[model samples]
Target: MSDFRSQLQEKLGLSSVDYHSNLSKEALFQEALTYDKGRIREGGPDDEHKAYQTRLGVQGPLVFYTDPSCTGRPVKDTFAAAWPEFEDKIWWKPDFQKYDPEAYLGLRKRVVEHLNAKNARLYVQEVYCGVDPEYAIPVRFVGEYASHALFTHNMFPKDVEGVRDEDEKRWTILNVPSFHCEPERDGSKSERAVILDFKDKVVLICGRADYCGVNKKSMFTVFNYLLPEQQELSMHCSANVGKQNDCAILFGLSGTGKTTLSADPNRRLIGDDEHAWTKDGVFNLEDGCYAKLIDLNKEAEPVIAAALSMPGTLIENVPALPGKPLEETDPQDLDLTDRSITENTRFSYPLSANPNVMPGARGPHPQTIVLLTADAFGVLPPVSILTRREVMYHFVSGFTSKLAGTEVGITEPVAAFSACFGAPFMAHFPSVYAKLLAEKMEAHHTRCILLNTGWSGGPYGTGKRISIKHTRALLDAALRGDFDEGNVEYEKHPIFGLLMPKSCEGVPSEILNPRNTWEDKDAYDRQALKLKEMFHENFAKKGFGAFGIEDVMA
Candidate 1:
């Protein structure tokens, strides 16, 4: 404790500011109830002394709302310092821009000065980003609000052993919701900015954007940058293992069924999001799950729904039931259908809350790799097998429809392509991850397939949603090797160049080939051609061929 202040002063210029270190969840709950700001009218009676009861025993759920301007990730406001040292290493996505190195240095100092002058009470939490001791990075989070600290506690690993030099190489997150940035002076796009200073190993969340995802995804960007250098593949995907010890990985962006499908009653979950594929196998980067809470069906996604009642869970941006006071209403009673708040409403809970999980948050080499896409256009086949190059092609393409109600201002499903399915968080070039994926798939002799869990006969409004019953049937058949070459006959997708099965045992054969189900084959061809054009255009713009991935459509 004696040198703790000096250490902060050395790295962060943080001193004379009182801070608590590694506080437990119980203590943090008390601190949030007392000190955290941005509480809404629905917030329970503003009393910190009372011990509330939850289903897990005794802790009231913590609900928080961010600034109306920052209900979702202020993607445009995010930046990375273009220091000459490592600027070339970053991919610099369309949404994640570069900040001047000189201006970034000045802005960071101003934030520390603001924290000291106000004598703001701070909380520090020490945790690791990944589960593997050999590569997990140690992270130190220093923030004014205990709620953010508790979020740090929920979303990352703690007490990890065998990490190479755990304390020496630290990534510090400077979270200050109170310090506003001046665009002209601080070189920020807005009053709030999430800046990553790779050279100094620092992440600054300045001003009023306190979205909890900012804390998680910022570190995810760091992991994506660091892991690839060691030859590990960092992914935005979900994984689970079946009874025969067969492990499968599903890659997709949010709302594309990665979480929903991977939580199969027949399989044990490895992790829901953010993982690393290394020489040994795959391991989870986070110790918790931050799942979407909008329109969540209790029967379909019982694991996440049941987690709402657990102690120490944080529900963000979900509004209370209509005409009911939040304090008196049970957590379950909060309206899930109401997009009155942001559709990105989320729930943060420790993995311990889940009943079925991989023993060590790690699994063996995947036997099956599934690329999930919600094709609102309804032109793609329901299931198609992929070769190694096809996997690389689609992996880099990362196409899915950005569903309406999932983001602020987005009123309908629009074609969305995020490289590696999460371009914003990928620090290096898309090929860095794609090349590594190809290597891993080859080394393990893995089977790859693309599955579309979107509309069937027509586009979203015109066609019916593909039945989950059928999607599950196809998924189960693939896992059991029913689609192997000898098991089922295959036909080529003329436009996309994918090998899709002609039939499956449980699924209707008509739906197997998407065009057959449509009333007008010509219309289906046009839509299919339009989607293929999208893939080709995105491919040409990115110039992925330079990275050794060729287009299947070509």
Candidate 2:
């Protein structure tokens, strides 16, 4: 205990009395069991007894609450007596628990060090829940040397404090609310999350969720904790605001060239994952970029390669041989099944990677809002400028592919319309972000454009994927305002929503429609109907039946 106290005091930069008086070491471990029990109850208390009996029959109730506040509870008493079940659930596998405690403590120390360096206040709290309807956990702590309580919650204390009220602070916070549920064998749980940002005395809640199914609950919670606040001018998908005058907002889902396209050397990067566009200008949500580090080819993404080689960048799940050179290893040959290494790679870079970017990673109101889509079906044109109404329509449409290996069967091209391109992460509802975006764009006089970076000549399996280089060229031309200068005529198609001509010079026109691209018109029609039907089914599952393909099919 003395050693622990010394360590805590040293890491927190607090006197021994300060450390002991507020959230002592004894409290942290003593609170752990109660916290675990609360998690079990909140996760699925109804199944608690049944699961307990199935795993360990007649061994009292299968759940328990160690918090003194939860005394006299039937479920808690029963589970407390059935200590074996609690032990079984709480114990991490030996291998899983084999991580170096020193390393873990080092991480905590590093976080404290960073916060202290910034002169930020710190608050620590412990939360515990019971398996009941009235499960309310109260977390309390003192704001040592805090100038103002910047953020607060019942379950956690102030996240960032001790900063001046008028310091031009830019930070984001996310809150995931507790929903009704109980414990599981795998130790997974659900919660509702929201992202908030506080800047210039205004609060913006970016995403919210209401009963969006159990699979997405954890994702929402994680999303909230990742950002500073829900209102902190952040969007769910990848976004990069150019630093130059007349800069535009680049938006795209996971794989649609959002990071690759936006990390242009000529344009400054505000952020790669999330950002907020206000009347004043655009504000970056993060200090780094969470880039997808899959199949990374230096020739394709040189800046990203350089970023990976730099410091302050955290690489998750990438295979690197100890004492071996990084150049000799081919990222593509790494194991694809390891998500930590293959799929979920993040790259953090300073906002000043590009010189033309706005200083302090801020930008004026977007001159253009470019929505990127990876149309696996090679039929859509490379680019199409849209009116405000059209932008709103497409914003709600939110079309994109499911990426390779995400779904079985139909691994080929398919149409998926998720509202705001982030239906799953939204906290309040589907139209919340879309409506806000429409309002913001209108107020800022921003135009909307859609760019397709997928197959252009045929269906997914048969057609050659569009050349990334050509897509880059087209994007560069658009950013330079070249297309707006040219008097190009758009041809409406029967199945696709819009089509731009090949005579536009930089873009190939043959991909204007699927029917024209495919050799067999019958096959094209069949594929089109199949995709349309799939869209209809997906929308139906979400209780949205108003959207119909025939209405847009020219």
TM-score of each: 0.94, 0.57
Task: Write down the lDDT that model 2 would get.
Answer: 0.42
The sequence of per-residue lDDT tens digits that candidate 1 reaches over residues 166-285 is 557678999998788999999998888899988888999988678889999999999999999898899989999999999899999876888889988789888998899999898999
Name the best candidate (by TM-score).
1
Candidate 1: stretches off by over 4 Å: 1-3, 39-58, 322-324, 403-413
Deviation (Å) of 355 in candidate 2: 6.2
- Give the per-residue Cα lDDT of candidate 2 at 175: 15
Worst 10 residues of 2 by lDDT: 73-82
In candidate 1, the residue pairs with backbone N, CA or C atoms under 3 Å apart (3 or more residues apart, or in different chains) clash, namely none
Model 1 lDDT at residue 451: 90
